[model samples]
Target: MTSPLLVGFLASFALIAAIGAQNAFVLRQGIRREHVLVVVSVCAVSDLLLITAGIAGIGAVITAHPQMVTVAKIGGAGFLFIYGALAARRAMKPSTLAPAQNGSARLISVVLTCLTMTFLNPHVYLDTVVLLGTLANQHADSRWLFGIGAVTASVVWFFSLGFGARCLSGLFAAPMTWRILDGLIAVTMIGLGISLVVS
Candidate 1:
């Protein structure tokens, strides 16, 4: 028989491992080696709070208020579209494609972007609150332990994605590589934004 903790860990990891706007942003920052700790911390802590809220039954509250999700979808879509356009522009400019030449974003800007990427996406709510919470509650008396397991998965994934990206510095040394990355990011952000609006 599967333990609640293991179930939670596996479930949470599977949900977040997908490439999304949040993950794309984290990957870029990790490649740049800029504000990686801040980005990782924000994502992990946000997951911690969200997973806790889910286990505490806030998922039910959110379910009762469908408008909240709608609002997030619209706002997140707009944000992603703009970010995607910027990334596309960057990808087109070879001068801006080099990691060393690409200037670092201000600390405040990184924090805000990270927060926006985390909280503005309705999918985050659906995954962490609705899905994870529902999964945790299925374990009955062991629900909190399930939640702890989920939170651990989140912490581990974000840190690994954020820091592990640094090892790719050698690969990203080429401006062409950065172009390909930014181009992919642009496509991903725009594609996700469009999906959010229609879905």
Candidate 2:
């Protein structure tokens, strides 16, 4: 039998490793070297809190209120669609890829966008709160350990994604490459948005 800690780590890793809006956004920021620390911190901390909440049984509360899920889905979809449109525009008017842009964005805006990406996405709740929580509870006495393991995976993954993206800096130096990446991000966000609404 798999240990609960290992189970939790692997489960969380699998869910988060998939390409999605959050990951794409992180990669973009990481490449740009813009607020990478803030982005990574927000994502890691948010995951920690959500995972802890799930283990502490907050998942049940979320589940009990189905309307909450609907609200999140609609709101998340709208945000994602708008974000996607913005990305599409960026792709169309490709800008030179630089480590830092001419003028950096405000810290507040970056934080707010990161929060929206984390909290608004309904899938995040489903994966971290419901699925992970349910799995952790299956461990019975070892549930907290499972939660810790899951949180560890989240922290590790985000830091790696956020920092590791710099290795691709050389590749993204070309304006066309930046355009392609933005285009891909746009597709991913819009695709996820559509799925959230239809599902």
Candidate 3:
């Protein structure tokens, strides 16, 4: 018999594996080795909440509301296009972000940045909450197990990204590297947004 917990974990991991802005930020922070714990904690917690909500049947409501989904799709796509443009713009400019002066500022920045990266992207909710949640329901003998699996996946992924990026920090230190990363981010975001809108 397939355990709901295992299924949920695999499903959650599968959903999060997509390369998106949130993952990008997590990787960048990991590379910088700045507030990696804070970033990972926030992201993991946020995912936990969303996944739990989905397992609790929030996804059913979302699925039932076609109009709401349409509205969300539009809003999300628009936000992505704008965010992509901004990233592209930042890539063009010379980076002037000084290191955080203190631990408090660093913590705050991590929270805010993670929040922006996670919440600002509509795809997160769609994939993790709505889509994954809906799928989990199909095999839900015990919904809580699914939620646990989903949360576990979030924790593992965030930690890996936060710590793993450190291994590649040296490669990304150059200005050209930043530009390329930002450029890719911009293009990816815009492409995703347009695709969402058209489809």
Candidate 4:
């Protein structure tokens, strides 16, 4: 039999390892090596907090009242659409891929933006609260342990993405590389937004 911890870890990782808006933003910040630690910390901590809430039974409350999900869905879709457009514009622009010596934004701004991406996204709630929580509860005797496993996966993934991106700094030095990345980000965000609205 598969361990609850392993199941949780795999499930959480599978849900999160996609090319979503948050991941794209994290990847960009990582490549720039700008506030990488802060970004990773915020993402991981957010996951821990959400997962804890889910395991603590908030998941049941959310599942019982789906209006919350509907509200989140609408707001998240708008946000994703706007963000996607901006990314597309950036991709179309012939901007250099090099990070400015001072970086584009303040660390606080980056943190705030990251927070918006984390909290405002409906999928985050659906995946963490409803899906993961339900899965953990299925383990019954080991639900909390399952949650810990899921949280650990989050910690690992964020830190790896945030830090490991620097290794590709050389590749991202070319304008075309950034263009490609931003283009893909645009498509991903837009596609996800539409799906969220329609689904």
Per-prediction TM-score to the true structure, in the order listed? 0.97, 0.95, 0.83, 0.93
Task: Evaluate model 1: give its TM-score.
Answer: 0.97
* Tens digit of per-residue lDDT, candidate 2, span 1-199: 8878898899999999988889998999988888999999999999999999998998999999978889999999999999999888888874433444435767899889999999999988888998899999989999998988899999999999999999998898788888899889889999999999999
lDDT accuracy of residue 189 in candidate 1: 96
Clash counts per candidate, in order, are: 0, 0, 0, 0
lDDT of 4 by residue, 22-46 (tens): 9999998998888999999999999
| lDDT score of residue 94 within candidate 3 | 51
Tell me the lDDT of model 1 at 97. Answer: 79
Local accuracy of candidate 3 as per-residue lDDT tens digits, 120-163? 56677678888877877776577778788889998999999899
Query: Which candidate, 2 or 3, has the higher lDDT?
Result: 2
lDDT of each: 0.93, 0.90, 0.78, 0.88
Cα lDDT of model 1 by residue, 78-137, tens digit? 999999998999999988876578677799999999999989999999999999999999
- Least accurate 10 contiguous residues by lDDT in model 1: 96-105
lDDT of 4: 0.88
Which regions in candidate 2 have their CA more than 4 angstroms from the true location? 96-102
Q: In candidate 2, where is summed lDDT lowest over 10 consecutive residues?
A: 94-103
User: Which is superior by TM-score, 2 or 3?
Assistant: 2
RMSD after CA superposition, every candidate: 0.9, 1.4, 3.1, 1.7
